[model samples]
Target: MSVFQSINPYSQALIQEYPLMDTGKINAALETAANGYHIWRRMRFAERAGVLLNAAKILRAGKEKYAQLITIEMGKVLPESLGEVEKCAWVCEYYAEHGETFLADEQIIAGYQKSFVTYEPIGAVLAIMPWNFPFWQVFRYAAPTLMAGNVTLLKHAPNVSGCSLAIAEIFKAAGAPEGVFQSIIIDVDAVEKILSTPIVQAVTLTGSERAGTSVAAIAGRHVKKSLLELGGSDALIVLPDADLQKAATVALQSRLLNAGQSCIGSKRFIVVKAVLDDFMQLLLNGISQYRQGDPMETGITTGPLARPDLAANLSAQLTGSIKSGAKLEYGGRFDGCNVMPSLLMNVQPGMAAFDQETFGPLAAVVAANDEQHAIELANLSPYGLGGSVWTKDIDKGISLARQITTGAVFINSLVKSDPRLPFGGVKKSGYGRELGRHGILEFVNAKTIAAEL
Candidate 1:
């Protein structure tokens, strides 16, 4: 009886209302997905790839439309929204082209005359995704899972319900069979019930640590495999020998992109004390370039926070950190969800901005005594989804990178997720991996077969 409403963050206007699926509809969807999985799993790898490739084609053809939907629905700037669509298409194409090779049987030398490991689909997989990068997150999981021969059931965030349905429509238009990919318009309770079903075999989530823990617990209870890509307080380490200009440029972009809603966005800037003042000046200048306005406008560099609550939460973190000794360097002005690009200096381990994930246009700068201290400060966070170490010396950078505790570390570069690399995190950031060969294999049954010649 309850209806879900989608609101445009920028205009604060109601976009659409979706009625919840009742028990009967939910049962029917599960049954359909189960049936589709049976057919999908039996198809040749080439055949499966063909459908995914077609989906990619559809995404490309409708890029503009989907980009507009993303901007209007979630307040992503127009350019970034378009880039998100392009990235989603890229993932689809990447998986369509390489998934079969990644999932191929591996030969093993053992006592048995013939032995091999085969990857087999594990029926329907439930994907619970977030809204920040709505399309990209879902496609990143779906492209590989579907290509690996498993059908997908997406439980996307409620705020991006329209984008969710649009993605489902794209798959259908690309000739995906009825339940190969279905977007369920349901609540959290419905998600738990669906996961409890026998047909849904596994789960993958990209959201908060709290959400990941809850879903992981449910999956554990049912003995279903789960992959979680949760919250991140990624540290951007800048050493004395690093290029401060380049580091500042990339750091600001990484922190401010998507209005700083990204999980892997650099939340803490760990700078060596020798170059702290210089890097601080560059960081301030870099932050000055961002201009927040209507996301649909072309020249606008940033947009409003996805929701008012998110803005308020980030504000609390900012005020709390300032009161705790972190000095406000620049830009802390906010009206509703439209927050100014802000920077906090002299941030220490105990400050709220340093301790918690500030998911908005706020950057925290923590001074480190030296290279070793920078690594120490970077590893100090409870959440370690991703981190980057900036240093001109490759060997030193690589050495320090190994010592940092995180999912993926980049040397002299920003942290990002690519279809070619396995991405995830340790600590409270969640477990398991997504993307690359590891992702396709995550939801599959790696059965070992041995036989006598």
Candidate 2:
């Protein structure tokens, strides 16, 4: 059997080790998930909602413990880790409160005695989650999936295996029946076998483009439904008439959040020529305040990357972009897993920093001739994830926001995911939606029932 270890990125100390589940154990989990699906699909909406609500309570009561584990395992600052846990609880409660209504039958206007479309669970769904926001990502998918009456199996990132098991326990303690939610500590090689199983109905993955493509291909070959949220080089467009201070502040906060590991975080700052210099100054001022140190320390505003390799990769991207004509305006030094918050100016379309998804605390600034050019620059990427348009004129911001092709676009605000809204991406960023009514319906069978008696 193979073993994997989780180490603190900040301290470089081993936290825990997990052994991979063998083929037999993986097969058993599949069988149990299949059985759980049968039981879960027949459960009432209220019953499932009860389980989710209980899970929310558990999450809140154990927030500190879970938050500490998140910080230790993934190197997110303690406060952010706590916020992630709270957000998980909020998602659980959100789905519990609204899932049934979201999945309720819709009346059809067909000329029959009775006609309607019913949403029903497809069966067991396999959620292949990432480690960046381990708890939030899983709950955002699982809460709605389970509340919609589908059992699920999880294949979380190896580095966050402890989080995977903890999530399984959350459901179990919340009164979920056997196998309703199982997290298997298996290697990537085992995913195909599980997906190939007849009992597995669909798959959802939140990871890199490569991983999403592979999983989508496997799901396609197996004829199972798939939803993917892949990598993004999200743009934050600052119009000439925008509030420079606010725009620069929000942009820095978004790019630096989670050490810049978020897919929705503003990776590129597209500023109009009129305010480019001013915005750059404000942005640099904000960057000067970011302090990287022990994630558990309250005074530290930034933490280490989840791994040292990520820091190295970010450094390489910076170097490539600079060679391609991007000027390093500020920090670009790396120490182990810690990357000093860096800024690159004169970033153009073809540069690595502009074109590729830089997954650390590095910010790229691109100058645009005008508003039209700003929108064009925003849409230049193959990634159509989340984006934002900043302008003092709310109406102008709204109009420009419509021009940017992405899953979600925010006007005069940072791009974020909300339970009340649908979230996903387009093009190479992956497809299908999650959250709100659209999310719960993703893995469901929308059966049209028409009858004349």
Candidate 3:
């Protein structure tokens, strides 16, 4: 297999093959990024902010083209891909507008002296991002670090190098120093050298739990910061009092968004016994209407699951679940990389799909006798990324949402990302927040200035 062949998920056609990056290039980029940080970190915040805002404009103007690359490279539906572009641009502009205030030093008084806290760029950061939400993943890490005055080097997935390079172009066009944001289009082997380098201050990754574990180990050995955003088998709970139709609709949207590729996606549906049948039937009808075909088609609600392996794994998982007593409903077959929206019922706690991340268009149905059982099922997973509870009673929903052991939980709503909120998880779902003020300080040094009297 070619290291860089572009395979169109729609037609399963080989589009093009680009050269894989070598270690030499990666080392050069690391050096350049480190040096760029020296300059970028010292530049006036207003000046850097101007560049970021300009980058945002460039992103807005080129949104279509960027979205096209995302769909072409990874097979995300065009509209959703375009939405990712817009969100990415918004994050950049958000940081440009608010980063200064967020990073501003605050003065405090010691007993007869003054002490202040100041945030500064740590240095260069290495971002190992995933193919899903390609632009959003990179920018979520990049925008905050850059706004905090750090330089960045991205080691993007090989399949989406084109998108990676496109992002670099945006920074360059925005008048950033040549190395301020560089994409090292290299293979997995090249990462170790970059991480071990003296220049790379920390590392961040948004991918699978295995990937996060690997990165965490490498960063640990190097004594560097590693912000991990890992996998999630989040719960979507529907209380007995919940509007079954609304619960089903939001569940369908939350689970199938991005073809169910997101880390914080709603994977497990925990419904109270009182409305299990209603929620199940509604879920079936709802997912059945999602047309599975070429992402470019306007009628299509779901598309191919990135690559053929994803389809194969999803199929095998669903099959095993069926053999283990779970029943498949809706669309469960895989034709190439497309595993049609699948629902599994009678899923007990021991099944892999019950706790493991299916990572595609497969949703597991777990029956809960009551709200307490719902919380128990949601907390049973090692992955604690995100979850949602549906209830007409807002107070009860909030109470139950607080019981789930996840980074984020929603009541009467599906979980999602927002620029104003901190997003991340505990447990195997990984550590560190991705957006908001807390995210900006992840790669920064919060130094204290104290006076001795």
Candidate 4:
């Protein structure tokens, strides 16, 4: 059988090895999931909530332990890893508290004497998640999925196999049924086999554009629902009236969080010419403060990319963008997975940094003549993920925010995912919302019933 090794990205040491499940094991898992779904679907909403609440307690109790796993396996800074674990617990608690209300039956006025719409579980859901924000991504999906009475099977990124198994243990410890949640440490080749099986009723993927396309196609062929959260080149627009210092700080934070491996991180900075110089100076100051070192250290603000190939790919993008008329403003060097928090100026539409998703600590700045031009520049990308608009005028910020062609927009703030709000993207960044009331509805059946009195 094949094996998936979990290696520490920083130390370059193997931490653990997980054996990939064979055909027979995979078949057995599917059968178990199918049976688990039946038991989960029949349970009361309160009972389901109890399991999730227990999960929240468990996550908080073991926050440090779980956080260490994330940092060691994925190279996220220690503080950020701790934050990610806390956020996972929050999502579980959020769904546990509000899931019943979100999926409550809706009364409808129809010609029939009685009419209503009921939300019901479909079956087992397969989630194909990425390594970046591994814990947050899985819990955001699994918490709601389980509360909605659907079992889940996680096919996490191979590099984070240990995280995947640990998640299974969380559910198990929280008193989940045998098949209610399972993590299958299988290769990409097995995705099709699992999706084709009758037990999996729907699918969700958080990955690149290529993976999203392939998974969506397979789900379509099987007549199952699919939700995708793909790559993004989100724009962060700074207007003339914006607070240059604050904008620069938030921009730097968003661009460098998780070493800029976030799909919704502000990859493009569209600054109005009136305040470009001031904003750039402040941004440079913040960049100077970042210290790259081991992720486990408390003082180090920057960590290595999750893999050497990722750093290499990011280096190539930086080189290609610089060659395509983009100027290297600051910091353009790589030592293995440790990037130098590079910044590029004079970036245009054709440059690789502006056109493609730079999944590293590389920031691209594009100049705009005015607010109108800034809005226009932001809309030029095929990605419509989350973005932010900075302006002193709240009304003006709201007005300009409406013009950006993205899924979610914030004014004078960094773009982020919240349990209370819906999150996802449009265009090539993929489709379907992932959180809030909309999220629990994604993999459920809205059955309509009408009857005479």
Go through the candidates in order and give each one's C-alpha lDDT: 0.92, 0.93, 0.88, 0.93
lDDT of 4 by residue, 1-453 (tens): 499988898989999899999999999999999989989999999999999999999999999999999999999999999999999999999999999999999999988998999999999999999999989999999988999999999999999998999999999999899999999988989988999888898999999999999999999998889999999998999988888888999999999999999999999999999888988899889999998889999899988899999999999999999888999989998998888898999999988999899999999999999999988899898899989999889999899888888889999998999999999999998999989999999989999999996
Give the clashing pairs for model 1. Answer: none
The pairs that clash in candidate 2 are none
Off by over 4 Å in 3: none
* Residue-by-residue lDDT tens digits, candidate 1, 1-453: 488889999989999999989999999999999989888989998888888889888988999999999999999899999999999989989998999899888999999999999999999999999999999999999999999999989988898999999999999988888899999998888878988998899999999988989999999999999999989899999988898999999999999999999999999999999999999999888888889989998789989999999999999999999999999999999998899999999899988998889999899999998888888888888998999989899998888888998999998787899999999999999889899998888999999999996
lDDT of 1 at 352: 90
On a 0 to 100 scale, what is the lDDT of residue 390 in model 2?
91
Give the Å shift of residue 276 in candidate 3.
Answer: 0.6
**Per-residue C-alpha lDDT of model 3 across residues 1-453, encoded as one tens digit per residue:** 236766887788887677866666766788788789889989999999999899889989998999999998898899999999999889988999899999999887766477899999888899999998889999888888898888998888877888888999999999999789998767766777888988898999999888889888889998999999999999998888888898899888988988889888899999889998988999988988888888988878888888988888887788888888898877787899876888889898888789588989888999999989889989998999999988888988888877889999988877898887899999999999989999998989999998877
Which consecutive 10 residues in model 1 have the weakest lDDT in total?
A: 1-10
lDDT (tens digit, per residue) of candidate 2 on 1-453: 498789998989999999999988998999999888889889999999999999999999999999998998888899999999999999999999999899989999989999999999988999999999989999999999999999999999988988999999999999999989999998888889999998899999999999999999999999999999999999999988888898899999999999899999999999999998899999989999999889999889888999988888898999999999999999988899988889999999999999899999999999999999999999999999999999889988889888889999998888988888999999999999999989999999999999999
The lDDT of model 1 is: 0.92
- Which scores greater on TM-score, model 2 or model 3? 2
Give me the displacement of residue 400 in model 4, in angstroms.
1.5
